[model samples]
Structures are given as C-alpha cells and as structure tokens.
Target: MDSLSYTPRGVLTPQRSLADLTWLRVGGPADWFFQPADEDDLAAFLKALPADVAVFPMGVGSNLIVRDGGIRAVVIRLGRGFNGIEVDGETVTAGAAALDAHVARKAAQAGRDLTFLRTIPGSIGGAVKMNAGCYGSYVADHLISVRIVTRAGEVQTLPAEALNLAYRSSQLPEGAVIVSATFRAAEGEPGALEARMVDQIAKRDASQPTKERSAGSTFRNPSGASSTGRADDTHELKAWAVIDKAGMRGATLGGAQMSEKHSNFLINAGGASAHDLEQLGEEVRKKVLQTQGISLEWEIMRIGEY
Candidate 1:
C-alpha cells in the first residue's frame, strides 16, 4: 500500500487498533486513522491524497461490527470540532459527531420534540446515514438537510429527498462525509418531552440488556407477506419473536450469545471475538430459516474482513 503523502492539522495514525473505537469492542487495526481538526482540514487532506485511497467515514461505533482482519481504507473520524448543537425556532442544527442522545436531550430542553433519538446510541452521522428510527419515528421524518464533504473535497448541502430514505437505510453518496445536519422537530412542552425521554429510557432498560456489550438489534423485522403466514396479512414479524420461536434465544458460540433479555441483541458475553459474534448471528439466521422459513436481514453494519 502507498503511504499517505498529505498531512493536515488533524491527528493521523497508521495501524491504529479499531477494537477500542467500536461499541462491540472487537476488531483489528485500521490502516490509517484520521481525526480531522475541522471540515477544511478533512477536505484538504482528501483533495491531496491519491484518488485510489479508499475513505470510510465512521461515527460512534454503535451499530457496527468491524472484523478481526481490520479495514484497508483510511478511516475518517470526526471529533470535538464537529459536535456543536444549536436550536432555532423548531429547527435543530447539530454537528455530525454529536451523540443522538445528546441531540435529543438538547432538542427536548429547547421545547422541540426529537424524542426518537433519545435512546439510540449512535452519533448524528450514523443516525442520518442509516435513517435511524425508533418508536415509529425516523430521521427521515424530521431531517431538513445535511452539509457534506464529497470525496473530491467539495462541500455541498443536500436535502433529505436526495437520500431516498427507507427502513433503517439511506442512499448516501459514496465517500461523502456528513459535517452537520438540520432537523425540523415538532414543538412540545419541555417538561413533557423530558418525561417522555425518561420513560423511554426506563422502557429500554427494562426490555434490553442495556449494560451488556452488544450492537443494538442484530436483524431487521421481516416485512410484508414473508412476515405473515397469510399472503393478505401485511404486518411485519419482529426479529426477536422469530428467534425466540426458533429456540435460539440465549444460544451461545464461543463467548458470544444472543441476549437472553432481548433475543434480537447479539452480545459479546466476555472474551467474545468478532468472529464469534458474527458466527453466532449466522447460526441464528440458519435456525430461523429452518424452523420459521423466514430469512432474516442484518440491521447492524458489518464491515472489514473476516
């Protein structure tokens, strides 16, 4: 691999271990890890670097599983300089690096209802990238636009329509780094919003293994006719219910197990390797397919190599 020739004000490290940067805490090193000081620094570095060098922009590693073999591309991580949050009227502008929880709390405090983000563990960038939704509300329902840096070092603002957002997915331009996003939230009483968020936290804690090391939901709910036994039924089938029905709840492989508390979660139950977690997930898929005849789709993004 060619060494990166350009240097910017941001911190750059080669062969940086990625295990500590992710929620699941199991991965190999990134060939190059770049923490940009600001948008200008990021743009300049990308403009000067060889066009062949692949760039992967990552947010807080909440819903990701990087393989043990690590990533070959340059991993761009936004930090302090990109975490600002501001509110005007009912619109909230947040930097891509800001946590979804923080954004939700701030928006709620400002009497704007963005409560759907309160329980999500990812950063704003990931939330936008995934069209993250919970409790029936999604980012696609509130996002106004996003400011992004293109792969060729150009800055552009794209409206929400450009993303073609769907259930837990969005079509963002490849290699585009989201710098900031504007969301139009609804007006609400501050006290009511705060109380609602508290209730959500409590509900999540009661239902999920919140203290464990897991990548949120492991699979998406099966939709349409596939979910229902009858072709006329349109209701989605929950992933957890199917896994439970398959008798794979609390199933283990190595140190990885599907959480007993919530069958949808794939947990690193002490000393679990990335391979173990991934293998366990695949096992669940096989069991579900064999017993329920419904193929499950992954909700968590698995990257890098095995």
Candidate 2:
C-alpha cells in the first residue's frame, strides 16, 4: 500500500489489530488506524486524505463484529481529546468518545435524568448512531443536536431530526463522523437519579450476562404487526423469549455460545473467532425462522470482509 503525504498531531498506524478494541475480542487488523489529537486535527487529516480512501469512525466497540479478514478503510478512533463531558442547566454536552456510563453519572450528579445511558456499554457516538436506549427511554428522546465532520471534512452541527432516528437505528450521513452531542435531560433530584441508576445496574446484573465478554443484545426485538399477526397493535416481541421457545438458549458453536445466562447475548466463551460468533448468530436466526416463522434482524453492527 502507498503511504499518504498528509500528517497530523495524532497517532496513525498501519494495520492495527482490531481484536483488542472490541468486546468480542475477535477481528483482524484495520488498514490504517488514526487517533486525532482534537477536532481540528481530525478535520484537517480527513480533508487532506484522498477522497477515494474510505473512513470509518468507531466508538468503544461495544456492539460490533469486525470480520477476521479485517476492514480495508481508515479506522478513526477518538480518544482523550474527544472524551470531555460538560453539564449546563438541564443540558449535557458530551464528546463522542465519552463513555455512556460516564455521561450518565455526570448527568445524574447534576440533577439530570439520563439514567438510561448508564448500562449501555458504548460511547456517546455509538449511542447517537444507534439511538441507544434501555428502560423505556432512548437517546433520540433527549438529543438536541450533534456536531459531525462530513465526508468532505466540513464541520456541521445538525439537529436530531437530521439523523431520522428510529428504533435502534439512525440514518447518519455516509462517512460522516459524530464528534459531539448535546442532550436536553429532564430535571430531577440528584440523589434520586443516582439511586435510580444504581437500581437499574442491579437489575441488569441480575438478569443479563453482565460478567460475560459479549455485545449487549444480538437481535432487535421483532416489531410490526406482521410478526405477531396482530393488526391493531404493533408491540415488539422479545427476541430472547422467541429464541428460548425455539430451543436455542444454550446453543454453542466452537467457543461461541448463545449465552446460557441470557439467551439473547452472544458471548466469546473462550478463544472464539469472529467466524464462530457470526455463524452461531446465523444459526440462531435460521432456527428461529424455522420454528417461529419470524425473521430476526441483527441489532449488533457487523462490518468488514469475511
């Protein structure tokens, strides 16, 4: 591969391994891994780089499956420079690299209600991209605006509507990188909010495979009236319940297992490869379709070559 002429006050490496970055701990290397010093550095680097080269911005890699053959794009991972969090009144402005748990804690300390983010094991950028939610509240409900670096290296602050946020998905502009987001949190007692977060954590720990090395949920709960044949209401059906009904609760493929503790979670039990995990998920999907006749859609993002 040819080296580019542009350089910035940041770290850029060739063929950085991605296994260490993701929760699943199974993927090949990225063609180039760039970590910018700041927003200016990121924009400048992007602008100088050839337009034909692909750019992929990643967060903490909570809900991702990078194939073993690796990604061919320049993988941008923000670090210390973009992890700041600030709270003013009822609004919290967080850098895209800031962890969701940290943002939730800060918001609670400031008497703001964003407890739903506490249990999400991702960064603010990933949360915004996925409209991440738990306990009935989503990022879309609180998002005010987001700052993004467009594919052409132009910076823009877009409103929440620009993404057209939906259930666990958003329409981010192709190759755009989210840098920061402003959220309007509701006011609440600091102590009460803290207590609520603690309770939520306890509940999550008790019900899910909290200690396992796994991406949170494997599949989106089936929605639409077609899945349930109920015309009046479109209540989402639980993926876990359906998987359990299909008798795939403890199914395994090599070192990958549909977590016995929580059927929906796909875990790297020990020394699992990306292929093993993905194949297991596909098998579960096939089984669910065969038994329940309901097509399951992946909630976790899978990228890169096979």
Candidate 3:
C-alpha cells in the first residue's frame, strides 16, 4: 500500500502471526499487520487500502476468543506511538490502544478516579467497544466522546450518547477504528486509590482464577423476570453460583474446562483448541438453561470462525 511508504517510521508486516496477540493466546496468522506511526499514518493507510479489503483494529485482546482458523483480514494494532495519555483537569484523553490499567494509573496519578479500569485486562478501545465495567461502574458512565476512523477511511468525533452505549456494548461501527477516547473521571486521592486497587486485585486473585489461561467472565447475568410474576434484577446473581448449582462446575471437554475454582471462568486446561473452549461453554450454557430458567449470554467476544 502507498501508506507504507507514506510514513517513514511506521511498522508494517505481511502475514504476521496472531496467536500471541490475544489473552486466549490462540489464532492463526493475519493477512497483514499494520501499526501506524501515528494518526496521520493510520489515516493514510486506511484511505489507501482497497475498498474490498477488510480492516480489523485490536487492542490488548482481553475479552476476545479468536478461533483457530484465524481472521482473514488486515489487522491493525496501535502501538505505544498511539498510546499516549493526556490528562486535563477532570478529563482524560487516551489513545485507543492504551492499557486500561495504564489509563487508570495515569488518571489516578493525576488525582482522578478512573480506578474502576485499574484491573480490566483489555485496552481502551476494547473497553469503549465492550462498555467494560467492574464494581457496578461501566465505561458508559465516564466516556465523553471518541474519535474514530470509519471503514470508508474518514475520521470523525462522536459523543458517547451517539454510540447508544448500554450494559456491555456500544454502537461503534463494525470496521471502524478508534483512534482516541476522552472520559470524565471523578477525583480521588492517589494513595487511597492505589491501596483500594491493590486490595481489589487481591480480591480478584482469590475469588477468580486470575492466573489461569482464561477470559475473565464467560457470561453476562440473566436479567429481568424470575417467572414468579415478580420484577427482578440479576445484578446480584453470580454466574459461577448458577453454573455450580447446575452441576456444571469443573466440567471438562478435551483441554478446556470450566474452572473448578470459579465456575464462571473457562480455562484452557492445556492444549485446548478454540473449538473445545467454545463447545464447553455451550455445554455449560445448556446445562444452566436446563437446570435453571435462566439463559446466559456470552460476555467474551467470539470472533473469526470455527
């Protein structure tokens, strides 16, 4: 592409391996891997790429489950060159590829409390797209706006409201690449924030299998009615509890197993292929549905193919 030459310092690779790019540590090679030098390079590359070609932008893939067959498109992963964090008063503008923990720490250092993002393993882009949240605080709460490059190669700024963000999702266009996002965080003391984050990490480590080869949560809690004719909210219901109650905890299929420690988390016991992980999840879902009246929706994004 002309954009490879357009930026003298950009990183470009033809048919790069994608296996290690995700938290799942699985995926075949990408047709192309482009890490633009900066915003200008990104724009030029997108503008010059053939219209028929597909562009997939990824960050630190925490919430993803890439299939074994791999993605058949150009993959764009922003580098440190686009990972700068700028804090101005209560507002923080961060590059899409910035780690959620890094952004939280930077904001915390500035006396702003974005500490809710302190433990999420994904990047800013994934957080924005997935509306990532913890401890009842979701990205839809603080996001002010985001700058995105559309599949048509045009860049634009959009307010969070325009994204129709809700729960664990956003209306971000499929094929659109987020360059940067601005969020509004409340204020907090650095010391207190750090201490709280430390405690939170410890709590997570104990309750969840933080060291296991697994995505954080496998399913979103089933919401609404309980079939008792009473209005209900499952916000208090734990996915693991339900799975355990359904007798699916510690269930295994090949190298994939529902974690014995945390029934909600699926672990690659060892040599687990994407199919094993996916099918095991499906098995868990079926068991939950049969035993309980609730149906679980996947929280981890499943991409590529079987």
Candidate 4:
C-alpha cells in the first residue's frame, strides 16, 4: 500500500496480533490497527489513506470470530473519546464505543426506558448495525438517527429509515463508520426501569452460559421471516430447539463445544483455535441439515482470512 499524505494524531500499529482484542481470543493479526485520538483524527486518517486500503470498524468484539490468518486491512477501534453518553428529555445520544449496558443504565437513571440494552453485549454501534433487540424491544424500534463517517471521510447524519433494519440485520453504507446514535426512548420511572433490567439480567444469566467463554448465540432462527427476531415471532422456531433435537447439544470437537446450558451457544471450553470453533459450528450445521432438514444461519460475525 502507498504511504499516506497526512499523519494522524492517533496511535497506529503494524501487524498487531488480534487474539487479545477479541472476545474469542483466537484471531491472528491485523495488518494495521488504528485507534484515533478523536473523530477528526479518524476522519482525516481515512481521507488521507490510500483508497485501495480496506477499513474494518470493530466494536468490543463481543459477537465476532476473526480468522486465524488475520485481516489484511486497517482495523479501526473506537475508544474513550467516542464513548460519551448524553440524555435530554426522552432522547438519548451515545457514542459508538459506549457500552450497551452503560447506555441502558444511564438512560434508565434519567427516567427513560432503554432497559432492553442492559442484557445485550457489545456497544451501541454494533447494536444498531445488527438491529439488536431483547424483551420485545429493538434498536429499530427506538433509533432516530445515526452519525457516520463514510469510507471517503465525509460525515453524514442519516435517519433510521435509511437503514433497512430487520431481523438481526441492517444495511449501512459500505465501509462507513458509525460514530454515534440517537434514540427516542419511552418515559418510565427510574426505579421501575432498574427493576425491569434486573429481572432481565437474572433471566439471561439463568438461561445462557454467561460464565463460559462464548460468543453469544451461534445461529439465527431458521424462520427466514423479515420481522424482528423475537422469541415469540410468528414462525416461532428456535435454533437451540433444533440443535437439541439434532442431538448436538453439549457436543464437542477439540476444545470447542456447544454449551450444555444453551445449545445455541458455541463456547471455548479450554484452549480452542478459531478453526476448532468454526469447524465445530459447521459440523452442527451439517448435522441439523441432514437430520432435521432445517438450515441454520450464523448470528456471530466471522471475518478475515482463514
């Protein structure tokens, strides 16, 4: 790649190992890793960098599996400068790096109901990108608008409608980095909201393998409907049920296993390479297709070379 015309104030590292950066802790390296000092630094760096150089905007790595061979691109990670949260009336604005749980608590403290985010992993950016939802509430239900810096370094605010948000997916302009999001929440008493979130957390911990090394849910429901991915959707098919019927619950290959607590969860029980986890998932998929005749789609995002 050609040298950049401008020098950014941010820290940049070459061939940075990515295992430590991901929740799975199994990826190789990123060709370049950039942590911008601020929004201006990020924009300028993207503007000055060569057009052919790829850019990957990463959240907290909560729902990702970067491959063993690493990413051949500049992986941009937002930090403190981009993690501010603000509340005004029923509207809450949060930076991309702000944790979903933090945003939920802050909004609840301000007497606005965003308690659905309290149990979800990762940041607001990833939430918006995936249309994350829980307890019948979704980012698509509350998101008003988003501020993003396009791959060309042009900043723009787009309405929530601009993104075709649906079940576990949304469409953003390719390579655009989400800087912040604004959500209009319902008004509720702080005490009541806190209580609701507490109950939600208790339920999640009881059902999911919260203490294990896992990347949330492994597969999407096989319904293929475009509506929200609620537990009570019309089609109402669950991935875990299918996995259980296929007899792959608690199944293991190498160090990776489908969690006994939640068959939909793919966990690293001990020392698991990315290959082990991915291959095990593929095996589950193959088994489900062969036995149940239902194809499963991955919910976790996997990237980079293998």
On TM-score, the leading prediction is 4
**Candidate 1, poorest ten consecutive residues by summed lDDT:** 224-233
Record all residue pairs in model 1 with backbone atoms less than 3 Å apart, i.e. clashing. Answer: none
Any idea what lDDT model 1 has? 0.90
lDDT of all the models against the reference? Answer: 0.90, 0.90, 0.83, 0.92
Candidate 2 clashes between residue pairs 3 or more apart in a chain or in different chains: none
Candidate 3: 10-residue stretch with minimal lDDT: 225-234
Backbone clash tally for model 2? 0
Predicted structure 3: lDDT: 0.83
- Residue 266 lDDT, candidate 1, scale 0-100: 97
Candidate numbers sorted by TM-score from highest down:
4, 2, 1, 3
Query: Could you tell which candidate, 1 or 4, scores higher by lDDT?
Result: 4
lDDT of 1 by residue, 1-306 (tens): 465566789998899989999889999989899999999999888887788888999888889899999998889999999999999998999999999999999999999999999999889999998888778778888999999999988989999989887777788888989999999999999999999999999999999999999989999878733211232123457889999999999999999999999999999999988999999999999999999899999999998988
Residue-wise lDDT of candidate 2 within 1-306, one digit each (tens)?
375567789999999999999999999999999999999989888888888899999998899999999999999999999999999998999999999999999999999989989999999999999888877778878999999998888999999988888777788888899999999999999999999999999999999998999999999888642211232123547889899999999899999999998999999999999999999999999999999998999999999999
Model 2, which residues run further than 4 Å from truth?
1-3, 225-236
TM-score of each: 0.95, 0.96, 0.91, 0.98
